[model samples]
Target: MTDFPQKARAAEAAMRAVFDATPLMRNDHLSGLHGADIWLKREDLTPVRSYKIRGAFNAMRKVLDADPSQDVFVCASAGNHAQGVAWNCRHFGTRGVIFMPVTTPQQKIDKTRMFGGDHVEVRLVGDYFDQTLAAAQDHCAEVGAHFLSPFDDEDVIEGQASVAVEMLAQMDGAPDVVILPVGGGGLSAGVLSYFRDVSPETEFWFVEPEGGASLTAALAAGAPVTLPKVDTFVDGASVARIGARTFARLSGVPRERVLLAPEDRICVTILSVLNVEGIVLEPAGALAVDVLEALRPQIAGKRVVCVTSGGNFDFERLPEVKERAQRFAGLKKYFLLRLPQRPGALRDFLDMLGPDDDIARFEYLKKSARNFGTVLIGIETKDAAAFPALFAKMDAAGFAYRDITSDETVAEFVL
Candidate 1:
């Protein structure tokens, strides 16, 4: 345990053969907003657009260095980790079997394939990640291949520590605070371990998607526990259970230090950074940044670093991302309206909309009777405050409506 720092530094040193250290630059935009010196550790800029490569490279390197005859590697990942393993397999000239959920985006699958080229074979195994993982592990045991636990393995944790190793080297001094996005806990565990040893005074904050608050659950239970359900929208960090080995290292963290970023709110941050700073971030990548609002009181006037975790975002999901962001910000809404089947009724409803309100979707479900029709309306406005006045006007004009924007059952079908 005492030699952990040395092992981490060695891993950092070994990484130079594969890729340069990700950038750690002071972000003036975030700094101004938070009243703190905010620095972004741009892990999203890695060759594989994530820090998963660090762990994959290190874990695979150590395995081969220890046993030259061990040439086969197996891993299950739906996103960045798969790409990282594939990339490393190509680098080491080893055969890698990468398993991904059958539902994984084609964009991600393609990228993983492109990264590994001939060195890796991707297997779309199951509809869910757990099934995919089980298959990969079973295959590894049957074939005697090296099974790489994405976050649970010791070597992988050490490799992830390299992020902290580079961070301390890149900065003038230890930052007052370091914000990390928690997925399966490898990155957080490795980073927190290294930082606690090298820079004891540096404070740490962990952020996870609300839909999959594994860290928070673990901290409460005194052990890692599986979440009943996980929202995979922030796929990068939506682990149902935190890694056991990784959680062992992170066990001491206080509950207050663990923040949950709502899935929709993360979309808002993704769009904010993309449009404001011209920095593209996937939902998981935006976790640390999204929690800034919650941490503002504590972080003010402090030198803070936020790890922007990954940028392997599929542009095809841009519209969905935008819609989620708008909904979260209260700038968009969906509702069912009962409209009278009379001439000029549509025009009257349109006229009731404020100048800033725009109808994004207008569809008639069906004419319930000869006198009335049920309509689904999606409205977008410049300000959320405009909603109250619009609803008031509707009430005065005897408009019967049901706000279904937040109704999960209805949204799942119509949205």
Candidate 2:
């Protein structure tokens, strides 16, 4: 009954009032793919469709027990945190003032409202989250309201530890390896703390979006360092800086265990879990699972548990997710080629197609040569190795081309 385990058990007890334990089901698909016993701690099924609710619920509960009549709780978030806070306010019969960036998606805003109902009021302010956060803090100060943070709070970290408590019980014991995604570090920190106390033998694999690998960067530098720019593709786990208190708990962890999941690779995993396993996960939620491919050798025969952080996925982005996945796996490609205008030239090029290759997109820009035209083509194929053969045929046929499928700058503008 160390302090860490005590805190986690208390956190788990508090959460039972809102929602029972989320499922910790063994995933057959993942298990077969990785050659290991794979299980998923489905935090995605939490009340706010994320693990954020644990922190929000525990923090608010503590506040209420102290005063029993705290009026308004203020928070600034346009993602899962906002929804979690709103839901907690409603549950506690307290008022919530949420400040969101004006650019926040209608889906998120609508969900937050739906969760909080009349217990919450949303203020759309600022163009970016930083601005909205500042506004929310100032307002809370002026009104004497408690400004709850998404992370960066010791109480919230303790609240998040509840996930580990449920995981241990649900799994019937400790897992050999626990894959946790690191955002602002509240969930990872809390889970790590709980394991430190009770299951020190368990290994940890900390995952983060490659575009925003704050924990990885900090480990490399031997201290926290700010990222120049962060990609918000994995919004839940994309943090420019790790929490100070959280980094303190996790600072001594081995750097080799921290993994960076590429954004496009994550999109592929998200789509795979959705289609193959009938499980929907946000980009961040898939981070831990996606790293399994990267750590196949290490986890080959071990019992592994990956935290599926959240499922607040917007289905409207499915097409984009598929497009990204195809690009990353080399199942799709874009090329700019020189095409001759001669009568038999187009027919000659068409004859070079491989059996598995499919033309997904084709367009012609202005002719670049007197007797030739610049043609932009998009190709899809069954395998990545098919491209080299396709290119060989195109070269032997005397057609010149450049592959631009992986050129981010070029892809952004033309593709």
Candidate 3:
């Protein structure tokens, strides 16, 4: 364990053969927002658009050096890790069999294929990641190929520690606080282990998506336990269970230091950074930055570092991201209204709306003989406070409506 820092430094040195160190630059925009000296460690700018490449490169390099004749590698990933492994397989001129869940986005699949070219074969297996992982392990055993665990392997963890090595070397000294995004925990574990050995005084905070709080669950249980379900919206950081090896290193983390970033709230950060700073970040990539507001009290007047984990966002999901952001901000809502079937009913309803309210969607379900109709409507407004006045006007006019914005069942069907 004493020589771990030496080994990590050596790995950092070897990474130069592949790509230069990602930037650790002060973010003026975020600094102003939180009143803190906020710096961004741009792991999103890597060749694979993520820090996953660091671990993949280190693990594959060590394997090939130890056994030059080894030619095959296998891994299961939904996105970033597969690309990292694919990119490294091409660099090392080895065959890689990559497995991904059938539901993975076509953009990710294409990107992985583009990175590996002739050196990789992609297999679309089970609908869920767990099933895909099982298939990958079975295939690996049958072919006698090395199976690469994304976060559990020792070499991968050491490779990930390179981020910490580069960070400390690039900055004047250890930061007052270092916030990291957590998925299966490889990046956090590696960074924590290295930082603890060299800069023991630095404070650390971990962020996980609210829908997939694997680390939080582990801390409470005193061990890694699989979650019955996980939301995949933050695909890069949505793990059902924290890795066993990673949990061993991170078990000491206090519950307070592990923050949960709600999925919709994260969408707000994603769009804010993209529009204001002209920086693109995926859901998981924005986790660390999304929590800065919550920690403003503690981080103000201090030097803080936030790791932007990945930038491999599909632009096709932009609309969904915008909608989520609006919803979370209370700037948009959906409602089911019961309206009189008489003429000029919609006009009367429109008149009740404030100057800033705009109807984004309006549809009448059916007109009944009872002189009333069911209408589906979506409203967008500049301020959340506008809703109260609008509802007051509706009540005075004897208008009946149901706010379906938070009803998941109705939303899934109508929205």
On lDDT, the leading prediction is: 3
| Alpha-carbon lDDT of model 2 | 0.91
Q: Give the per-residue lDDT of model 3 (tens digit) for 1-415.
A: 5787998999999999889999998999999989999999999999999999999999999998999998999999999999999999999999999999999999999999999999999999999888999999999999989888899888999999999999999999899999999999999999999999999999999999999999999999999999888998999999999999999999999999999999999999999999998988999999999999999999989999999999999999999999999999999999999999889998999999888999998988875577898999999999999998899999999999999998989999999
Q: Write the per-residue lDDT of candidate 1 for residues 294-323, one digit (tens) a residue.
A: 899999999999999899889999999999
Higher TM-score: candidate 1 or 2? 1
Which wins on TM-score, candidate 2 or candidate 3?
3
lDDT at residue 309 of model 1 (Cα atoms): 88
Q: Looking at model 1, report the run of 10 residues with the lowest lDDT sum.
A: 365-374
10 residues in a row with least lDDT, candidate 3: 362-371
Q: lDDT of all the models against the reference?
A: 0.93, 0.91, 0.94
Off by over 4 Å in 2: 367-370
TM-score of 3: 0.98
After superposition, candidate 1 runs with Cα above 4 Å error: none
TM-score on alpha carbons, each prediction: 0.98, 0.96, 0.98
> In model 2, what are the clashing residue pairs, if there are any?
none
Can you tell me which runs of candidate 3 are displaced by over 4 Å? none
